[model samples]
Target: MGTVRPNVLIILVDDMGYSDIGCYGGEIGTPNLDSLAAGGVRLTNFYNTARCSPSRASLLTGLHPHQTGVAELVNNDGPGGYPGSLSLRCATLAESFRAAGYHTHLTGKWHLSNEREQPADTWPTRRGFDRFWGTISGAGSYFQPTTLHDGETPVPLSDLGPDFYYTDEIGTRAAAAIREATTPFFGYVAFTAPHWPLHAKDSDLAETRGLFDEGWDVLRTRRRQRQLEAGICSDDATLDHRDPAVPAWEDEPEQKWQLERMEAYAAQVRAMDRAVGTILAALEETGQRENTIVVFLSDNGGCAEELRSDPEGADQFRRHHLIIPPTAPDGTPMKVGNSPGISPGTADTYTSYGQAWANLSNTPFRRYKRWVHEGGIATPLIVSWPAGGLTGDVIHAPHQLTDIAPTLLEATGVPALAERDGEPVPALPGASMLGLLRGGEPVEHDLFWEHIGNAAIRSGDWKLVREYEGPWELYDLSADRSESNDLSAQHPDRVQDLADRWQRWADAVGVIPYGDVLAARATMPTQPA
Candidate 1:
């Protein structure tokens, strides 16, 4: 007479491009993910907030990052972990599920805050997760990661063994969590693959050695064409060119290093996919396969962060910006250049593939992560729910990360609790996608995003986006998914109207002023009026 409540699994991959998966039209071999797509709904227009911590914060809290006080990456110094930490005011998705009688578990990158070293109440244990086994840092040596935690305890990952890969380790733990979970579980398995410090097993790395020899241009063009064929974008959408930082492949001094860099990245993704397969197998073994609702997505678009070499160097860059080489008058480094031969796949390097490669990574999309453009913020969302609950149809509605929490709550019949410890938390800000999932009318709503004063507002088919240093750009996303045609000059009134709406959202949420919010917090205590 009633629908069966299913277990929930939210798998978020780090720095994965929208077109990287095989289903999304990339060279990457991902059979496990492809199977999920075939059996479920492939969402083409879902978007993230365009960064790691912000997307994660909004996804968990159902509110924008500014409202949760994690507008950027949380650091130890910032209040409520402004740059990279979670705030106390926010109630996480895990909390909601736990309150609803689900056993909550989390593994992989816990970039929320490094409260593990601080106090018991500030750690993941206090953040609503009943069981936690993961790292507290953002990106680090995959071999012996720092801040690797078992609940609140700082434990060496070596305990897991030497040959253990971080991606596989996380996946194995996630599978075990499911098998051992006594009640319906909420498992948030975040894999930090394809991030920085690209390290893959020798076998995994060897498989992709000759893969990128085709070079960035060829790979990017091929991927873009595949995306077009898949109806992921408007046919007329032009492929966005590479970033200025990325040097042309022909100009690269060492093609071998470039090829190896990408090879390692691909291997990392492959390992993650394999791990997903393991978890899926566990779901079936536990008899929760068909009824379980599994949603897989990337945290943001392809990441283009320039990783540093070595924990010391990365720490130096993080603390004092000392690792960045000094530049001459012409903006070229006097001594140290952004050169290869730092030996990628080692523990000492922190280099991104640069914008040229990132351009290829995002394929037909306009920009990479951090911008509000299609390439940067857009991501592939695959939902797998059997038992005939969700229609196996592709829905192209523009969904934001905030909608994830509400969708989960509605699907699992979990209600958002108003109070935690007698204090009222923020209400859910996202609408449930249950209607769309059940093949009902298309859900329509305006989505907003603001990070470091770069703002965007998408209302229906029309989207208005503005970066801190650029002019306002308007696009009818229904017509121009590539964002090649800027209608800012053509439609002045509509631009103003969207701009006003963006400001209204910024004011409604607590979007910080452009620049370092931590710096503002530092000066507030002592500065005289």
Candidate 2:
């Protein structure tokens, strides 16, 4: 790196798919993200933990989510499996970098903590971030998100002006932080965009007005071909069939409604990319563009959480989801559903892109978020550090989110803290990919993942995976990146070996069976997670 201690910037988006950005084969206008990918190294086969909080826990701490006590959402599951709050036993990236003389700052989402009404130690400020501001919960409306905090203090809704938008605010604040940092800084921008309650600016919506009018059936084929042409996927890699539950575009009755949902989703992505552009411009204007180590990725795969017409009162809706606001910022009653009559892309409207659009988001893949399948876990990972000589290259390395923290620490010459809060921390199971970022060949390794009941283990080129309560299926991912063919019957022994390995890991990481975990949670008193 050019500077003695390079600045660090990690940009994380919520529930984005593998090929949603222009450089990755999607038709969306993501010029900023595409430019970032062109100026960095793209990981062709990077994976996440297949859920939000689990993936965030892994990415920040460099440990499996089970090790950090966040195997699932920040729910009070009562410990049959894991705790909802992040364990202080493992030091976060901010803590490590701060200990090494960096001014650590966090902007946007902070779902690691389960504390809703009462103050909790797991909040971002107490986690070693010098400055922190964002939501403590998972998902909500972009117009008026609940749980807005500024370093442990809740931000009032009145302060967010009538025209405020969450995605825009997240990017704008992050850029301001970067420009104000007087020392080498470690900034984390966690954008909750393109997640749910799809809301976008009028201009952004205009850009994608008729983009998905043809619907998912035709778009999947076009996207897959683009993926192959761009070398994001292998030439022989075939697009998986559309999700079984989704009706064909020709067979569907709500064609106009479906098209509108996708347009809003596309607009959300474009808005996120525009935010990314501002962050990048901040790096450039501050003269830290080359030396700054910038990384961009989504926390998980595309979300399929469909929002339907809700009959609950506004107060009842707020009672259920801690992140959801009861009304719009202007005190307008929000329409919380994907009702065909309620056109989205406005402050008073709340809706998701739904399953059919999610299928297009995860084009060429079978399952959606929360599954251990390729569509659920696969994500685009971009690492750029011009001063470190890692630019404009592709690494076909099958890595996971756990590798991120270690890689950043290594590049910045910082050590993962050996101990925290007067207790010893465990060693990070993830190895640094800093070497690979700097033109080194990829070294094969085994990777494992579990969420809810879904499980997967990738060993070398062979992957053994299954849905919750489903049979194990094996695939040679080198030839079938789409995971269309299952080879379990032909190689039962390999399946057995991988399964045994996965079991051993689960036991080591405190993974309880999905049923057992749910049974435990059911017995506990319910609270906002």
lDDT values for all models = 0.77, 0.86
TM-score, every prediction: 0.91, 0.97
Give the per-residue lDDT digits (tens) of candidate 1, residues 1-529.
1455678899998888888898888898899999998899888889998888778788778888887767766544344225345777778888988988899999888777634355445467788899999876676556666667888777744475657678888989999999999898998998888776566788888778888897887888788788778776667666666556677778878898788778878888899999999999999999988888899998888876665545564454544221222232234432221347555664434456655666777877767788887777888999998864788877888898989888988788898878777789888777788889889887788899876667799989898988876789999887788777889899999999998988888888877666656466665432110
Which candidate wins on lDDT?
2
TM-score of 1: 0.91
Supply every candidate's count of residue pairs whose N, Cα or C atoms clash at under 3 angstroms. Answer: 15, 0
The candidate scoring highest on TM-score is: 2
Give candidates' CA RMSD values in order: 5.4, 1.5
lDDT per residue (tens digit) for residues 1-529 in model 2 = 4457899999999999887888888999999988888889898889999888999899899999989988898887885746788998999999999998999899988898878656688888889899988888888778778888888788888888877889998999999999999999999999998898778888898899888778788898899888888888888766687888999999999898888888888898998999999999999999989889999998888888876576764345556657567777667777777788888888788788887777788877878899889889999888888888784777787899888887888888899999998899988988789888887877677999999999999998899999898999999988887789999999999999999999999988878899999899988887664
